[model samples]
Target: MKEHLKHDLEQINHLLDIIKKQGVEYLKLIGARPTSVNHIPLWETQNLPESGYGTEETLKIFNQRFEPIMVGSSGPRYLGFVTGGTTPASVAGDWLTSIYDQNTQSTIGQGDISANIELETIHLILELLGLPDSFLGGFVTGATMSNFTCLGVARQWVGKEQGKDIAKEGISGLIKILTATPHSSSIKSLSLLGLGSNNIVKVKTAEGEREAICIRDLEDQMIKLNGEPFILISSGGTVNTVDFDDFMEIKKLKEQYNFWWHIDAAFGGFAACSETHSHLVKGWEYADSITVDCHKWLNVPYESAVFLIKEQYKILQVETFQNSNAPYLGDPLENFGYLNFLPENSRRLKALPAWFSLMAYGREGYKNIINQNISLANQFGQLLERSNDFKLLAPVRLNTVCFTLKDSEKQDEVGRFLETLNDTGKVFMTPTFYNGHSGIRAAFVNWMTGENDIQLIFETMNEVITQLK
Candidate 1:
């Protein structure tokens, strides 16, 4: 068994060598290919067949099955779904994390691996966003779980004020939710938490372009309610055009209506790093809780999300899971069950990569990366505006650019053309429907992306559009 484990470890090391040497080259060739010869077949086999154990078969499988998918995310033009390319340091840190393989549930179990990294990363994040150090931060799976944790705490606090014990007893009555053009994830979170999506009051936006939750409509709805504790959801970044909702107005409503304010800043929260874009998210400091993903703007690996709670003990009050008398598992000096703060029992030390990246790059490094993307996005928008064959669909805010193809009859046709660009291995971009019209969307969040990449995408887009013409 020891021999076999050592052999497997060597094979993994060999694979990493291949990744280091050929990863970037392979990405340039087929990274954003729509339907290139760069994908592995998916199967549903449950068991493996016994065969002659040899290095040849192992190498073949490694090359054929894993290499394609591995290079998919390392490309310069992968702009679908707000995915971020991993930095070399963070990737190496991930390898170390797997090698150590510690279960970071509590300080006692992991011996400072869990507590120290979490504390350092959270402090760095708070300082980066210019928030108070008193905030409580938890590293969760992704944005969805982050939202679940944040909303869960809000539910507990509001229920407690109304003389109900939500932690002891689950939500039993009808709870109303108010949202300003919620991302589908927020609505799905409400559903998962037993709050029906139908019960949510969708506030109207001012212009059809930006989805700002109308303060007047929200005020009217609150007055009609029968004093039921509500959850008011506001977005820092709209998924379609990256528009920010008026947070100052939303904050006023939070005070007047006395409801919990939850800001879903999954992709756009990191823009606060720049002074120029900071005003876009004004009044975010007043939020009850905020959700930010390190994978997006922070350029870290996947599954690094932070849910910041303004009131630290609120997490302990709402999410205390186990309270047993196991002597071995209990520690009097430190909270042995820090996992109770999140939904998971055995958590990953996911904060290590973020902490390492922040430590390596510092604040100025982060500011430069974010500001570069913002400027490059605007430059891309300008490139589109200069073209007669393309039309700029929405204002370039933060890092997203929305535009449409000219001479297209329907929005679906434009969407089909964009998919063709992806299929041809030229570039990878996604389609989004804005104001009921289909359009192409490009989000620039990868640290490796630069003006050259943006220009290449624009050139490829023009080529695709000309082919359609």
Candidate 2:
């Protein structure tokens, strides 16, 4: 064995101890860490070395080259892009996931029970969201991959309705998809699945600054298809304004239309945990497939989300994603492998962090997190509304506040304001365009965010605005 490899194996416990100390220190000081940095150093890359540096030496090199500029994106004040903070239990599970290094694929014949644990995690997630066990699910990298997986199955199902196996025969003809406002990831997923992203029939949003779909206009668009089957991609919660489509109304339409229903809940699906906000996803269980991100609302680490597709469509999912003609791996249908049901063939035990988080927090814990975040969002929205310098684009319906400068003529200054505000290193928010106006979105998904964070953000925004003015 290589000297460095042998050394690493022998000193694993020491290395782990060092890592744990670093992690604890970072977490403890996360609130004080910068949400954004103005300057980023460009590290010089070295050529491949014939001799390896030991783990300790390599970690030292990484810290020198990279650690300083690593902004606290997972921190409470980092409100950009709907990012989530890691929970202590989730961090523990994520650590074990790397230590175990299990390739989570098969449930029965693989001798590894990671897939069973994954399935149990899915069950816990279902219970947390009040979803039915009829929906079979597995972990993916994030909502983007989850969207890709579910829409891939939707594409195959659409082809079957048209009497063509698109997965096997290749995509042909127009595939109609209807939606009011889908996350950009969903459109990218369509493109990846060979369904043209530009081909979606853009449905009208509900009246008056709402991003939710107009159900009547949606039905009109469906009628224009002349009874042909299509896909209806609805939003459980829109990124801006947290607007949710009427799932109950959509469910009613599902019984009448011959279409595949997909709801991209992503972070917003956690609203099901809040008694007051549960109405947002009233009939989401009726969806053919749903996407939920564990990293966002579940407070797990990155690259974790789940695609829950109805078990009735298992055959279509397998047909869409099957790794056929492999003799050694056994039949895809005979063995319940994740490879035949999602985009990736080999996957990490991504569900462990989620499982650990669910087990640690349980329903009430997550409910508190969800409700608190929602309350914080509202609190932030009220601050924005009360401020003379900012104007809310819409009501804070859930956990994101979409707002812009109060002065309509100063719309061009929005970007500059956001940049300056972020550069303060105290708080961060992302720029957005909504309803034909430039805006900023501060999404509150982090479990650590409290009234103090909101106050700091508000004060920082004011300071930035004053300077910009």
Q: List the residue pairs that clash in candidate 2.
A: none
Candidate 2, superposed: residue stretches over 4 Å from native: 326-334
| Local accuracy of candidate 1 as per-residue lDDT tens digits, 1-469 | 4555567677876756765666455645544444233345795653554543445455576677655555355455787778776776777677677767766665554364466667678899999988887677778888898888888777787777677867667877877788877888777788887778998987777665677677778788888785777888888888778878788888777776778889999988888888899888888988888889888888878888988877554433334344342322433225534456677777778888888788888899889988998998899899988997777788898898888865556555786688668866656778887775778888888888888888877888878777877
RMSD of 2: 1.8
lDDT of 2 by residue, 255-348 (tens): 9889999999999899999999898899899999999999998999999999999998888888888788433243444668887788887889
Error of 2 at 198 (Å): 2.5
Worst 10 residues of 1 by lDDT: 324-333
Q: What's the distance in Å from true for residue 412, model 2?
A: 1.1
Q: Which candidate number would show the highest lDDT if scored against the true structure?
A: 2
**lDDT (0 to 1) per candidate:** 0.75, 0.91
Instruction: Give the distance in Å from residue 139's predicted Cα in candidate 2 to where it truly belongs.
Output: 0.3
Error of model 1, residue 51, in angstroms: 7.6
